[model samples]
Target: MNTSPRILVVEDDRTVRTVVNDYLSGQGFSVTAVDNGSEVLARFAAERPALVVLDRMLPGLSGDEVCRALRATSDVPIIMLTALDAVPDRIAGLESGADDYLAKPFALKELKLRIEALLRRSRQAGAAPSEFGLGPFRVDPARRHIRRDGVPIPLTTREYELFLYLLNNPGRTISRDEILREVWQWQFGDPSTVTVHIRRLREKIEEDPRFPVHLKTEWGSGYRFDLRGGEG
Candidate 1:
């Protein structure tokens, strides 16, 4: 019985796809490689991959469209690959539901490390069973779920991690660097990653994202979560 984690690699570039597939396979992952976005959902449904490596640009459907479609029904971790390394481009990828983003000219080792980290988190989330509440929010650790005012809020893996981290800390101001290190497990990377995730979390939980009550920014310091302010 081969229980290696399955991985779906969606890249239009032939060379890149082949290299990634070979590398991941060599690293003991069961890789299903595809050439376009159109095949992503079918493959995903069929393979039920542990993670997806998606290209930002595709011949049809577009990577973002495919990502959004997958996110509609699954919290599966997704890592977006793109040549566009601009802040806005990365932000767009993250906004479209990618749990992580890598520039086209990226290291394969880094990709493997990311995939391992996500899988590890997924497993840990499943193994833990704890039900906790703070104000309007409730966390179901076993289900990897969080609800606001009795309504479930859909969050990607990364978003959920960030939310729980902040919720656990309560009112302490946390810097972007600290968030990146703790939540993302990255000592060095774009700070925008944390910023975008925070924005997304606010949009989902806050009555008004622009005037967030629970997840508040502490000026130049960072962000603070206030359970009392958000409590009814």
Candidate 2:
């Protein structure tokens, strides 16, 4: 009975790939390493890893393309590795459906921590609350499904977790740092990832994302989800 989590590492850099493989293996993960984006989908299907470490710049499919494809059908957690350290590039990666992002030259220890956080959050979210009816939305925790007005709104794992957290504490202002701590389980992170997930979730759940009614920003504080939206 093997309890170690299986991980898929999709990276083209040989040295980085070896280093990561050895580190994660030492950290007690079952790792399957692949070199090209072309083989990612196939290997992913075969390995069925608990999480994916995807390189943003790949020769064949590109990480964004792979992320989009994975998001279409699977809610697996993805941490995109990239050399692009720009904020816009990070936003693009988040919006493309990665659960997290790590710029190249990232600390392997930090990457391990991020992976642990994501897997822990996922396990907790899946453990209970088979169903939740929040205002006009239905959140199925067991299946990781969310629906609004009887229409399914596709959400990445992070988006779903964020939405669920906000819904659970509706009408209360949650600071960005608090969200990062509670939702992402990160003591310190880029924080922009939270912003991107919130923006994407607004597009799905809000009638008007520009002037969102349910998910509202508190200017200086953070955000509040009015589960009692369109009501007094």
Q: lDDT by residue for model 2 over 59-161, one digit each (tens)? A: 8899899988888778899999999999999999888999999998999999999899888877876576668698988988877788988898887778878
Q: Which residue pairs show collisions in model 2? A: none
Question: Candidate 2 local accuracy as lDDT?
Answer: 0.88
Q: lDDT per residue, candidate 1, 1-232, as tens digits?
A: 8899999999999999999999999999999999989889999999899999999999998999999999999999999999999999999999998999999799999999999999998889757868989788899999889998889999989999999999899989999999999988999999999888999898998888988889898889999999877541
Q: What is the C-alpha local distance difference test score of each model? A: 0.92, 0.88
Note the residue pairs that clash in candidate 1: none
Kindly report which residue stretches of model 2 are placed more than 4 angstroms away from their true locations once superposed: 1-3
| lDDT (C-alpha) at residue 2 in model 2 | 81
RMSD values for the candidates in order, in angstroms, are 1.7, 2.1
In each prediction, how many residue pairs overlap at the backbone (N, C-alpha, C within less than 3 A)?
Answer: 0, 0
